[model samples]
Target: MKFDVVIGNPPYNKGMDLDFVDLGYKISNKYTVMITPAKWQTTADDYSGCASKNINYKQFREMYVPHMSYVCFYPQSMEVFDIYQIDGNYREY
Candidate 1:
């Protein structure tokens, strides 16, 4: 079995590994989009920088990692974010 398009609204919370989201891209033939939790909230990474209580957008963007080629909110101050198709993938499709 194969898929031309794969879409998912994955369950997310603190300390959740997003490896499954990567699977969506691996299986899809064309496109895959994952709507993850807002960057403002603290995630598993615990990377220092984002001070959400102060409404620090710059810090949030700076701390965001393991994602590139993504569609991000401009002047992104507490906005919804999603990762787009990256140049290379974790696995061949």
Candidate 2:
């Protein structure tokens, strides 16, 4: 499914990696709003979406809060790509 805007809270907490959920929302490149931990900033390198050295990505904006969740806005253009996580989950990022 294609979309211009995406807004929602994916499954968070309970040992969920917010980055995975963020990447899952790759279907919406123009804009995305998600309430999640700010931990995703440090995991940018871990995302397969950054595999290409030439890909330019804008830093995600979020209100930094550890224990408390923060809403994040990622208004960046990304080339849709696919990868198979070792856990057998297929994702498009």
What local distance difference test score does each model get?
0.46, 0.43
Q: Model 1 off-target regions past 4 Å?
A: 15-17, 38-70, 74-93
> Per-residue lDDT of 1-93 in model 2, one digit per residue for the tens?
868876665553322534444454567756666554343555543355432242212233232123224444543212222433334244555
- Give the candidate number with the greatest TM-score: 1
Model 1: per-residue Cα lDDT over 1-93, one tens digit each:
557876776554321324435566668777667665454344334454432343243333453343435655443322333433233122222
**TM-score for each predicted model, relative to the true structure:** 0.41, 0.34
| Candidate 1 positional error at 42, Å | 8.8
RMSD of 2: 12.6
The per-residue C-alpha lDDT of model 1 at residue 36 equals 52
lDDT score, residue 78, model 1? 28
**Model 2 Cα displacement at 75 (Å)?**
22
